[model samples]
Target chain A: MHDERMISFMFDTNLTKHLAELSKINFTDDEIAVISNEMSEIISLMDTVTEYNIDETFASADPVQFSDLRKDEIKDSFPREEILKNAKGKSDTCFKVPKVV
Target chain B: MNDLLKCTVKELSNKLNKKQISAVELTDAYLKRINEVDGKVNSYITVCNEQARISAEKAQKIIDAGSANALTGIPMSIKDNICTKDIRTTCASKMLEDFNPIYNATVINRLNDNNIVMLGKTNMDEFAMGGSSQTSFFGGVKNPYNTECVTGGSSGGSAASVAANLCAASLGSDTGGSVRQPAAFCGVTGLKPTYGAVSRYGLIAFASSLDQIGPVARSAEDCGIILSAIAGRDENDGTIKNIDKADYCSKIGMSMKGIRIGIPKEFFGDGIDSEVRQAVMNAAKEYEKMGCILEEVTMPSLKYAVASYYLISSAEAASNLSRFDGIKYGYRSENGNTYEEIIKNTRHEGFGAEVKRRIMLGNYALSSGYYDAYYNKAVKIRGKIKAEYDEIFKTCDCILTPTAPSVAYKIGALENDPVKMYSADICTVTVNIAGLPAISTPCGYSSNNMPIGMSIVGNSLREATIIAVADAFEKQFETKEASI
Candidate 1:
């Protein structure tokens, strides 16, 4: 059990950019380099979790019973105007966004 | 400092009930204190002066009719992340700089029922991400004890306000030591209630599984008073437990004789500062004098708690924050032709560096190829951590340790090293990972005059016992007042 091989992850600017794209956040080349360096430190920190091979199943700390959930009955919600009050671009009763082809 | 401002919530409640002070006068005193001290403290993002005055007037009317509760006329600060109806709740980000919620959070509604006077929304780390509160778009919050030092965050302003007497008490959310660490650094009391003890209906979720609303106040009893007002099951929040609300302050001043308190040896190793360790040990001696028994115990999984915590929290944060695209209620970029471009541009412009970093890390951890190594492993380790804690609680009534590795340092001390900043949270994150109730109260001050805190952790849903232990210590402890 002590002679286990751990998967090595290669972190670089390309990987950082790929992650940023997946996250839907943009970053400059210089910013990506910085983030790449920072993420390496964080990844090394997280490697401790992989160092131990625990033989246990994952259980939630606070498990919610299915029956304990609130009843799925019809209820009053916020009005359209109240919900849309904070929108930057709003039409008559709905939020407006740029045209997506 | 005004004597009225120095009164704790219980003392002020008694004074209000006895007609010795009117609610308006108490509110004005706090508002005046904020006006004089907040410039240097930078604790508040928005001071609701007119709204506070109006609420105070109404509260006074309720008191006149002899229907006031402990918090009825108490002026308190709300962290910026909590939604307040008709008031701007920014989460200290540019994305929600001008966005005002049309509905109050369930906690806000509960507090309103008690006739709570809203002083203002306090500053915090942007989206409750950073530890120093420096990532806030508004500005960083300074320690009231020393303006150059940081108020440990992401609930920095909430603790700083209570320490500086800007308000009687304040509410702060704890994802991973946000409330307790800041309370430790700022020399006040903070309580992180058991998971599902308080509702999270309108809290801006960083990690839904770890976040719980707690109180930052000058005394543990004051925290209990606030907790009683806010804790209970709510239909709006599904995560809350369906249990009767217990009086958290009911056991204060209880005897500590023969209580078995566990001192985990892993928490006091080489990483802890010597002075901080000494202060906590001194606090243990005090408890010993109070007839409590100290037992040395060990928990091996505490070494991996930070890694497990960050992996899970950041992953949840990534998913929760995806809803803030250009289409909804947050900030929208001005220049983007297509919908996809618009969403990307808005996120790029709206989020701070720390928030973006977490998003990137979250995506990396949850990627298809790495999920088993990172996120899944973290969940398994989380289970192990909970198991280790359960073993200790079988014999120990409560656990004792330092709230932070060290006292607060100067701002920008760990700015360039994010790993170092994250590592400092080791002392406080384990309790959150295990979903237990804990309280951080001032134990002693450092040689440099900075305050140190010690935590008393109880079993899940055992808030009253821990609060009782903390209140007992605070009864004889000499707390230093910040001369802001």
Candidate 2:
């Protein structure tokens, strides 16, 4: 826990390229280094939770109960114009896309 | 009445009934306090003064006519994660920094139904990830006591606001001690009820299976009262059932004669600071004097709690956050080629680094090759953890441990280490993983006078018994006072 290099261990970039690809956000190596540094601090602060004597009495994930989530029934639908007003990009009566379309 | 703003809901309700203080005046007083102190704490993200004034005006009429609800005009703050219809529901992240929910969360609806004076929304960790409240896009919340030490988080702002008397009681979401841990840092009582005891209809998803909303207040009684109003079944939250809610304030000052409490040996070992452990031991002795019997219990599988919790929570967080494609209300990059392009651009631009890390970890854990070993194995181990708790419950009514290994550290204590920060949840995450009830009540203070909490847990849906044990313990301790 006392190693000075432990601080640098957080920015290992082990997951950087992979995560960037998945999340679609590209990160400069400097940005990755910064994120890793901050992450290391957060991880160290949370080290306390790992010390518990959970003694096999751990619980499972919460179970799903009866959800009133209704089927996708469109009621009182808003006009496309109103909804698209807040959209970053839109096309003729629908959302616009880049050349890939 | 300067004292009116400090009174608990129980006290305020009694005074309101006796006409010693009017609800409208009480509401105005808290609004004034928020105005005076909000700048220092950065606790509130929004102030619903218009709705508060309107609610207070109506409460005055009800009181004048001699008919009003118990919580009428009682000021309460809410976490930023809960939606309030057109009000900013930032989750303290720049991602949805300006996105507004089209509807209110059921808990918000329930509180409104009780006529609670909406004080405003409190800040939290960005997307409820960070523990020190440092991750908020709005800025970090300072501890009311010193402003140098952190107010433990992701619910840090709610705990700080309540500790500082900016509001009577505030509601916070606890995925894993989010409410209770912060309560300890700020010297307040926080309850994370049994997973399904309170509805999660409006809470923004972190790990949907783990998040539960609860109350943070100055006393166990206050937490109970707020819990009573906020508990019960909600059709909107399908995961919740039609369970009966007990009168939370009904059992206060009650005898703890036959209650059997188990003290887990693992919580008090070498890593816990001496002062923090001493505070908990002192609390245990105090509980012993309160006519309850204490027994030693051990759950050996808990050593892996941190490893198990991270695998599952991070995995779930990744899946839940997948819905935030830039196509929606959140930040979206201008890049759009294929459908995949929009997702990558939006997520890359919208989510911060920590979030991206978790999402990638989750995607990998749940990925084809790693699913069985990482995710499935963790789930199986989770069952073992649950089994151990189940075995112990057969012998005792509840369990007790330190809410955190120690008191709040400086702002940057673990800012460089994500895993270390995640480990802080080790002592508290078991209860969340188990889907049980737990509370963090102020037990004692550190040499520096920072608050320490005693975590009390009980069986599934056993809110009544859990609060009863905590109530008995809280009543006997005088150091339970908040530093502010």
True contacts kept of each: 0.68, 0.33
Candidate 2 TM-score for chain A: 0.60
CAPRI quality of model 2: acceptable
Docking quality level of the chain pair in candidate 1: medium
Candidate 1, DockQ score (0 to 1): 0.62
Best by TM-score: 1
lDDT of 2 at B16: 81
Report every candidate's CA lDDT.
0.90, 0.78
Worst 10 residues of 1 chain B by lDDT: B237-246
Q: Which tens-of-lDDT digit does each residue in B1-484 have in candidate 2? A: 2667767777887888788877778888888888887788888888888878887787777777877767776889999999887677889887887777777898888888777888788998888876788778888888887787888889999999888888899999998789989998898889998888888887998887778999998878888888888898775677885687668667666688867889989878877889988988888888788777899999776776776777777788987897787664666776666778777767777777667767766665576644654566666667777777998999998898999987988887876667778778768888887888998898888878888888899898777777878888766677544444
The true-structure Cα RMSD of candidate 1 reads: 1.6
Model 1 misses residue A20 by how many Å?
Answer: 0.6
Task: Supply DockQ values for each candidate.
Answer: 0.62, 0.26
